[model samples]
Target: MPAGELFTVPPVRGGTKPEGSSRNKQKEYQLVRVKNTWCRVECRQEMPTTWEEDQVIVSQAKIGEQVTESGVSWVVKAPIYFCYKVIETQNLLNPSNKTLLYGHVSDPEEIDEYQKKTQKRFVVMDATVEQIYGSKVRKYFEAHNVVYKILALETTEETKSMDIVLHILEEVHKFSLDRRTEPIIAIGGGVCLDAVGLAASLYRRRTPYIRVPTTLLSYVDASVGAKNGVNFCNCKNKLGSYTPPIATFLDRSFIQTIPRRHISNGLGEILKMALMKHKGLFQILEKHGKYLLDSKFQSTNVLDCNDDAALKTTRLAIQTMLEELAPNLWEDDLDRLVDYGHVISPELEMNLLPALMHGEAVNIDMAFMTYVSHEIGLITLEERNRIVQCMQNLELPVFHRDCSFQLIKKALAERFKHSGGKLRLSLSTGLGTAEIFNNVSEETMMCAFAAWQEDLGEHST
Candidate 1:
């Protein structure tokens, strides 16, 4: 048989028809396109035969219609909507009873009860993490009899591509995951979370998944956001979706396993949030900045819920992040406080990837913008210097060679389009407060960049 052409169909004549007659109709009509008043349809048979009322017509005025040139009228189904929540927790690797688990380490004795109400689980972990805690994770699962498949991969800035995401998708399909009950678990830093989250969003056309961030950056920033994507064509998060995980489990315990630079990298985002929205958080970072960078909460790590300072710092950072994100989960509003230092960070980060971590780039961005604030009198010289000094104390980079005035101008151009034709540049008016701007001259930006470079040289020497 030859291929058929695509043609519109008209609704059946007479708005209503007998149900029994349509159902028993000998001839069939395949609908092409349906509209409010008419439906485009085609007849496969050579000639019209007996029409069964019930077969074609679903209701009195809908679906099947009476024979006539005028089409019938019907109602289309209602639209669909989705909603979910993100949570914070400790030691998510521990088994649990409730579908949604949050907060603190689980007691060994409580495991028995917690596991009883659990569902099957699978994990997609960063390969590096598996090397560090593979045995521990396996032991925990075995102790609880929680059957799970682990798919570990190298999730690096360079490896954050669609090809990597597709590989994860293949692994997810192999598990034949149950979309609703069985959740896919992702464990690692931001890159790992991004790849895994993107994979979960695709599987079964959006399977529920969980996020277990293993780094300071992921804990405070990445895991909490609904944006999930992999890079493409050298653009950060070019191929992505705004799909929030079913839940996000924050375990400070995981940060203990990584080096201090990663912790400092995370402090970058914490600092960004502090400056943008939380004055208290900004003050906390300033006062306890050094303590946080070097304090050992546990014998094994930087995070100890027992350490009052560390707990306060971690809680404030997470809380501030949620405050900025909760209202703009989909970024429908581009004039966001959370975009504080993000205007130029994406390009700067990618340009310095493997050498400069994401948060490090953001710190550099914030530092430059703080200089911009000072130039415009939005912030005082002392305040601007204080922010830079705090970043320096935390071991975060305040300046990067790649973050030049020209680069910033170019980045702002791209940002204007991304932000819906508005500059929407977030600039700090003072500590813990920021305002968006649609215009800032290149001369002012260049001066700020120059001042940052000079400060960097002074600090270095």
Candidate 2:
């Protein structure tokens, strides 16, 4: 299969009749190019008059001749529109067919059964804080036919030490009897995923792994992407590789056991996504903020609320965000859609590692960025107030006073230096648009932090 031969057209579902005594109802269709397959999708409806109006058709349609209205049909002879070059395969196989694996992690027994059926090695990497749950995971694996291993690492700042991570990986590698045939499966939160993902990436030069993301943060943000890495020299995600997992098992069931603060931390990340990229998403979060808060503060679970509508809403928003952003993960077009407060968040996490959860740092970074947006006149005072209020409603830290301003300034300076004077901050002029600017001034950052501090003091006193 060659790049020149692949095409796929959109499948038109319903049809509409033509207007104004036009007896002939034109058929609509979309032609898209996959790897090496040519597919034509057609519908019984009026075809669009222009290429811009019918992208699905124009994507694969080769032009003919010029045409005009006034009861005349003409075609414009033009070159074929090539959106992307399809990869050439050795054989004419279905190269565009993606395999998806979905499973529930609600029951450890069910998870163990799935692993046994898949014939993959089940390894439970967990935080020492979650000893009981980790034990259950091990027990479930034992009950089934799957071989299991438990690497209990502490989630504290000290455990994120580079030497500790490396040692853990070494141990896992050394203990494995059959490295080539067996794949690794990790079950836990972001830290567990990161450590296990890093180890999987290194073992046998990148083996496949299945991720069972237990926490909300991992479910919505971390585990889906192929990015696998660990911290280096106390820097957050400094050492990492873009190695995607074979599959990700999202079990909202485990979220019931998470503490209130951790759950709130995850919501903080969710709120950041809503504020920066999707206006509709913001509305959804606004509607469900109370539900999430109650779910965390009380023993109530989100799954138990209103037919699980809150969880569904949150999952939908997260899925949309991932679909929009994941495709652009490797592309260097930073300004397109990476503007969810992660730029400064990483630096802050690195500087304040073991002190702040990643989502907590992101929450603070989003507030600071909003303040910068206000200072630069990119956003109005009312919008800033609304953003701050939304974060407060979610119980996320919305002020810079949560951390030392001087330390933050120093970290920003270090970030600038590390990126070779390029200000890699994800700033937004308004909702649904983000720009990565390297021209942000130190004075602008200082002013933003100062304003945030003032707001925090006012609230406290």
Candidate 3:
């Protein structure tokens, strides 16, 4: 490329030999003055340095440029770095736990300023959460003299839409927030977190939002990630952006109020991370699945008699999920193992909306993928059965009647089309290791579905 460039030799060439060494040194720099400051600036008159692979630029530092008669080519090499905090706090809404107020403020001076200021916060909460903790949340903010507006919506899978995002935007607009200083707070389940995150990402072209996950599902699965969206046109997360929160405050005590079924529902997601990356986590879920469900993730701090299995389980789930998500937040690489159950689950969940919880649909997808793994020799039948049994033990439905082979095929097709023309099927080879394969055949899918159906069809709901 350096040789083939449209050249201007007198200007571009450097380090000429003839009458050069001292002259070149003299020509290499020029004195410049700006703002009462005088300094020497190097005039580099050489070929631009660039890294190219397969005629495509992977990365370049400060960039090499090529100038043609028609235009000047320069890369605007600005890479974005976003740092968000995930704090495991206790009694977040309690007057003493100031994390809900000043935790996200990084600088001590900023925190002091934030505390001194009568803060105005815009809160988007799930209706269920508002009903349960509205008084405490209100009292906490009021205790600090924070001027706040809480918009409690019936945020469910059915209500995960852009219209709700607009509703949040309208309320946020009316509140007239300081986009830089005051961040929006989202307090609820995954759906509420997602919708509020999307709204925050949209308003002012990306304002900061804080996540307060109330359910176990949100605490482990949704609250930590950057991806946020509302379901669009019968597709799961079809309309979304990769915008993370300024901070995610995880208070496990909030999980205590959730129903027993919701606890099991959340385990489906934790199971996903385990089956993909951590065998130890899988075993923990395997051993304490029922105990967790029974206790609703109440740690020994609350239950006193039980061990701190709840803390370990949630902490492990979050760590493993972050291990996958932090590097690939924008999904620059499509071969994501975190997308294991997500492939077919999106379609299946949309198809069976209101009937199946998000994690249940994801479990069904994982169950079938496990069987597919067996069929393709990626996993043994015993391993597949064990995974399924674990699902059952966790009270997660492994089979949904609506998840037909045709639906599976269609979901894979959609995934293939969207995921750069590859299935990118994240199938587990064993308990905690997985690979993304693009070579899965339709025949194998049908066979796996048939076998999965034969094994668990009668149990389908």
Q: Give the TM-score of candidate 1.
A: 0.77
Model 3 stretches astray by more than 4 angstroms: 1-64, 302-307, 459-461
lDDT of 2 at 440: 71
- Candidate achieving the largest lDDT: 3
For each candidate, the alpha-carbon lDDT, in order, equals 0.74, 0.60, 0.84
How far is 145's C-alpha from truth in model 1 (Å)?
A: 2.6
Candidate 1 per-residue C-alpha lDDT over 1-461 given as tens digits, one digit per residue, 9 for 90 to 100: 12211121333555433433543222234443222223324344332235333344322121233332334323232223345555545555654523333222135555454546644567888999999877767766676566667888999989999888899888778877567557788889999999888888887778877788889889888988888998888888899888888778766778888888988999999898889888888888888877777862222433554456677777787888777777788788877888887889989987777788889888888888999899888999888988989898889988877677778988899998877887887899998888888788888888877777887844555
RMSD of each: 10.8, 14.1, 7.8
lDDT of 3 by residue, 1-461 (tens): 25214222235354333322333222223333433444433446422234122333222223323343334444333367899999988788899889998888889988887767789999988999999999999999899899999999999999899999999999999999899999999999999999999999999899999999999999998999999999998888889999999999999888889988899889999999999999988999889888889888877663332357787899889999999999999999898988878988898889878888988888999999999999999898789888999999999998888898888878878887888876788989999888888888889988988888888998644
- For every model shown, what is its TM-score relative to the native structure? 0.77, 0.67, 0.86
Q: How many backbone clashes does candidate 2 have?
A: 16
Residue-wise lDDT of candidate 2 within 48-98, one digit each (tens)? 434343334335453221112233232322332211111111111112211
Q: Candidate 3, overall lDDT?
A: 0.84
- Model 1, position 257: C-alpha lDDT score: 81
RMSD of candidate 3 to the truth, in angstroms, is: 7.8
lDDT of 1 at 238: 91
Q: How accurate is candidate 1 locally (lDDT)?
A: 0.74
